[model samples]
Target chain A: MWLAKNKDEREFTGGKTDWEAAARIAEQCSGFEPDDEDEQTADEAVSCYNCRYRRWTVKSFSCLLPT
Target chain B: MEIFVGIDDSRQLDGYKAGETASLLTRAIEDKGWGKSKIPSRHRLYPNPVIGYKKHNTARSFSADIDEQYLNPFITYACTMIKSNVASGCNAGLAVVVPERMVNRDDLISYAYRVKEEQVSKEECMQLAQCPGIYLFELSGDGRGVIGALAAAGLRLTGNDGQFRGKLKLGHEEYYVATVKEIIDKTYVQQVKSMDLVRLEDDETVRMGEKVKVVLLDNLYTLMVFPTDLENPKWQTSTTHMLRMF
Candidate 1:
């Protein structure tokens, strides 16, 4: 995740298409609580793509939590 | 009579997920003995950020075969529930369609597609919904939810778009195989098909994950499974990652 223009906000640098990378990043994050089942897009249950604070962007999602 | 209900933006920014509202409301309807309802469908709308929405701009909708006499009370009860259950400071929208009353449905469905591709105003939404037999209610806040609520009803009425809420818990605790006939009988899964676009025969074997779910495709609630190794009786459910494209 890279620092967004907003202070303390981070976005998935790998973008949204790279599913495995997103899941790998989520595997190490403590804030990876899954969102609702319908909102989840990752096949892996514990992926950042499924993270509750990952505000979805048209290209990639920005991590809403402070990093 | 058939009553198709759609609700959108019903959850507060800090409250329940908007995707879950329809299921909760449908359960409330059944609990009141108005009629038996089917599982709700979560229809995805345009995810345009310019619309003041950044995430989860989806609507919840379902259809029910209800008694004609219960119609008035049902709508009244539903409106009351939205006001009470929806998060405070949230914009809640609700739309109900009685097939017999909506003499011309093309206009209704057209609005559903319009929300997906263009910007629609609250005035347009109310005008379209202000027809005979079609009821539109704004529960709270700016009532912008009517935009998504009416759109959802149109999409659901078209019999396409959206994924069914909740994972279909089938097979073993983790994974197992079942015949297509058994899949239909044991679960709400209407039909099973291959990712290659072929509908599997009723007797064909399909291996599925514990968390199986169906999506709306070709106007049918379908479970797209893939062959494990192109062999007979070797198939697995399509992952949520794949199904999300719908």
Candidate 2:
């Protein structure tokens, strides 16, 4: 599920702390390239949480890259 | 003299991370013999949906020690690197400051904290950059990056915001094992504490996690640790999962 679907404000709706959901989404995501190591927040190696395209918001991050 | 460098908006149209530009710039600073640098630190800023490029809104900064004479050349070198590689048609901003000579301004610190929670104006960045000892330069594109660069320099001056770039690098890729004392003795890590900020005793052994890293707290490079499941290695180095709270 997604929260705000607006191009910029779209969030995963799983909230900011959902590590498993992020990793699962990333495993199959063709665009899920890892972000800079310094900025990665997730425990799993490959996750949208660590992607270079997830623009962070106050409560959750918005996926700025197209699916 | 010690020099502080702040950079932001280096992300390319393709998905290059901002920290990559920062770490490369710092590496060049060291390679050029200007001086060795402390690890680049990432200072996050307000994330507005409509503003800025890249995935996350953050800036990177580092401090290096060099002879005062080489300062100009070093800045030139850095600016050239950003233009040629990092910024490439992007609005990259750069700020260099000498803490000792810069007029101490609580306003600068306030400005940094403000950007973390809300949008800031380029006018504010320009005004703050005018303070003595502060030098601000735009490397490419629309120059909106000046706001973030100034904010990052402010964050660096405070020494309290952000996490160091790269891992602290302990034992090996799998896992590292050492006493809390050994970590501090061998590495620049000042202390091995827990998530709650409790400093572990030197004698306690911690199974340092793979790619273990440190956080800046109380203006010190800190290695925060936590407990493992009913094990002899009573404490464990903080993980990327844990340090993200910074």
Candidate 3:
């Protein structure tokens, strides 16, 4: 579900459309914080796609949280 | 006179958002009696990593029917507000367009679509600013935000782009049902339509879920819904995922 991009960053392997996977992963993640309401894309109130720490990349997104 | 205002702020991850600034501008306009402003909309721009945005690549814009005399003062106020509110070391841009005075709207519209499709530069945006009735300003930093600001104005002019910032609170419950006419009366939504773009009749019923939002469509505030149960043909507000394209 994640690809280690660096020592402190990991990218979501599901790309941009895997809502269920993103939500599942976010549910267990302690660092997850909801982004601005307008920026949130997931219907699930708690999802990585809606996390403030997730930075969108070309293919998917990178978690800014330290690994 | 009617004018469209667009702003792009490249603030830090923890800084105030561009949408919030746009919203503040809208309220300030109304409070100053400068104009009756519409709900602000958020335009999603090209998200390529090369552009180097801190987070989501988006801009906020809104339209207002203001006294033509207040145009210059309004612009000055907007510029000052953005500069003061934006985070340090960030770039902020402002674009104002008077559609009635614009001679080459098609060119601006095409540029907007191009910005969403590929990498657009500040030089290109500055070049387009030469067109009449279009104003662009660099409030801070390297002024790269002008690219998004200008694109935002053009996208808003298209009358068919961007989701409105924030949500509509119709009922206190997590989910509630209302007629299309009732929804229109309670909120800025001018029309209710299906995902396929078919307008729902005023008498039609809809079940609005949590965080109901509206989008710009055909130059009106539109609330889009989808059939909740095909068997019953009941309508329900679109989910966040469904409205992502806007």
Best by DockQ: 3
Task: Give the candidate order by descending DockQ.
Answer: 3, 2, 1
Tens digits of lDDT, candidate 1, B1-246 = 888898886433356555566777678778988888877888767654544434566788888888999989988887887788766667888889887897799998888988876668889988987787789988888888888888888888887677897787775555777889998898877878777778888888887775677887676778889878857667889877667655
Q: For each candidate, give its TM-score against the true structure.
A: 0.88, 0.87, 0.94
Question: Least accurate stretch of 10 residues (summed lDDT) in model 1 chain B?
Answer: B46-55
Pairs clashing within candidate 2: B193-B225
Q: After superposition, how far is residue A18 of candidate 3 from its true place, in Å?
A: 0.8
lDDT string, candidate 2, A1-67, tens digits: 4787666556777877899999988897888877777778888988878898787776677777764
lDDT of 1 by residue, A1-67 (tens): 5756467556678876788888888898887788777878788888888877777655676777655
State the TM-score for model 1.
0.88
lDDT of 3 by residue, B165-207 (tens): 7788887776788889999998889999899999999888888
The docking category that best describes candidate 2 is medium
* Candidate 3 similarity to native, TM-score: 0.94
Task: Report lDDT (Cα) of residue B93, candidate 1.
Answer: 81
Residue-level error in angstroms, candidate 3, position A53: 0.9
lDDT per residue as tens, model 2, B148-200: 88788778778777888777776754666788888889989887778887888
